[model samples]
Target: MCACKAASVTIVDGLKAAETKEKCPLCREARVYEGALHMEELNILLSRRCPEYWGERLQHERIERIRQAKEHWDSVCRAFMGV
Candidate 1:
């Protein structure tokens, strides 16, 4: 499960404690405000790695875009030259 889900669980537990007028163990354990769970989720997402091919795929796309743009410009130049 993702960290956001885990943080949501912590928030839910904290809400339950609030409803019962009891101390929230999760908050005590993490030593953070309930709202800080969202920050924890953000941190977890930032620390996560993308798929192995993600960078390669992005590079390939960049190269393809450049190639296509060059091809289009070449065609435009040829048209202007009446070729």
Candidate 2:
């Protein structure tokens, strides 16, 4: 499976060509047939469905969780020092 974030387009003989591209047909159809709001929603949904997007989101969440834990620990240590 290709792990590209966006559809890879290439110029060949003055024409655009997609290279190793995969997308949800429903999403593409929605973007073409639906309004701006619907297109935006479909785009968000598609991005979330992508593995790279999910991986990045999970990594960010993990980093945030670690940061929050460290903050909580520091606060606890400060409280203990004052006691």
Candidate 3:
């Protein structure tokens, strides 16, 4: 896998990519298809499907910072969970 960040891909671009096969880190596949899960949507979907764990209060400077942190976390989880 390429040690590349998809930051420049833009949030909207990622949203658009959601309708297709997601950019994979393992295969590095840029294949396009339907139903790929972007971070925001994935968070929403996961929030609905998974258990809620809002145990502690977050004191981030901005929501963007928190979101960015979760995005990194999500990638790591995906890798480990083999999602």
- Candidate with top TM-score is 2
Candidate 1 colliding pairs, count: 0
Badly placed stretches (over 4 Å) of model 1 are: 1-51
lDDT of model number 1: 0.48
Q: lDDT tens digits, residues 51-78, model 3?
A: 4432111122245456766898899999
lDDT by candidate, in order shown: 0.48, 0.46, 0.46
lDDT of 2 by residue, 3-80 (tens): 112233221111123332344344643222222235346547867689797678657656755766687789899999
Stretches of model 3 off by over 4 angstroms after superposition: 1-7, 17-23, 32-34, 37-44, 51-62, 65-83
CA shift of 50, model 3, Å: 2.8
Clash pairs (backbone) in predicted model 1 = none
Q: Cα lDDT of model 2 overall?
A: 0.46
